[model samples]
Target: MTEDTAAGNTEAPANPQVKMRVLGQFIRDMSFENVMAQKGIAGDVQPEISVQVNLDAKKRPVEHQFEVSIKLKLTSKAKGMEDVLFLCEIDYCGLFHVEGVPEDQLHPFLLIECPRMLFPFLRRIVSDITRDGGFPPVNLDSIDFVALYRNELMRRQAEQANKTEA
Candidate 1:
């Protein structure tokens, strides 16, 4: 084969390869202090949980990758009053296969795709937890992870720029 032909045949490595496996998943932390919540709300109450999602990624020494997640805080409050019923902080993570990936392309996949893949499971857990806690099942609205990721990146860049100028 000619050198030029050979060079043309070569393809760029796939970025952010995912060899995703559910390594081990459990309630990393759980609290069901329903008694206090019930006492706090002595009548029929509708509860709501506000969620904030965060995504982080890191490469391993070998081919593996880590997606560290903080699903933000979920605070359940009564429908009428401003009192909080319960609060939960769920921190979860996943191990991913990230091989044959270019350095430049890795960040987007980690920030966008990885979280998109993991969000459904996390959402299910939250819903189940709320239901089991005797409140109505909490169904969270779907998130636009790409937008969230881009905003976060922009915010970080702005912060860094401000710091540099300071």
Candidate 2:
């Protein structure tokens, strides 16, 4: 083997390393409706809410680097209301580096670690948005990345199976 290859094989390869560099952060988009929440607070109104979370990651040309983002949407409405009381969306991201690691290890880091790192920031934003809207702070529960990843994998598998069957 060539010296360079030999060196790489001998010592851990200088894996491409990625470090999240927060370029810029802003409220990409946000909306809050306190009027609905206020109306629902009393017995006259009953409140119902639905929340959806989505995770996505992309690799940058920067070697061993990736951008992982989480998007959340929350909708709150009254029992029989056609109107929404609260509708909010949050998009948060973080950069990560992966070097000297196998693909198996890197996969989890991108899917799990990157999101975990971004969660606190995303959570804070959600809390602030609700608080500013005159409602109690909405604190999101910690997520289990492993479980989330597994579910995603299963969902994709099922979808692929359906496609093949069809």
Best by lDDT: 2
Q: What tens-digit string does per-residue lDDT give for candidate 2 at 4-111?
A: 787775676576665444543444556666767555655455557788888888888988777787878888777787666677777777766656556777777778
What ranges in model 1 sit over 4 Å off? 1-27, 32-38
Candidate-wise lDDT, in order? 0.69, 0.75
lDDT tens digits, residue span 83-152, model 1: 7877767776666665555667678877777767777887898788778877777777888988998899
Residue 118 deviation, candidate 1, in Å?
A: 1.4
- CA shift at 114, candidate 1, in angstroms? 1.3
Superposed Cα deviation of residue 92, candidate 2 (Å): 0.8
Error of 1 at 2 (Å): 3.2
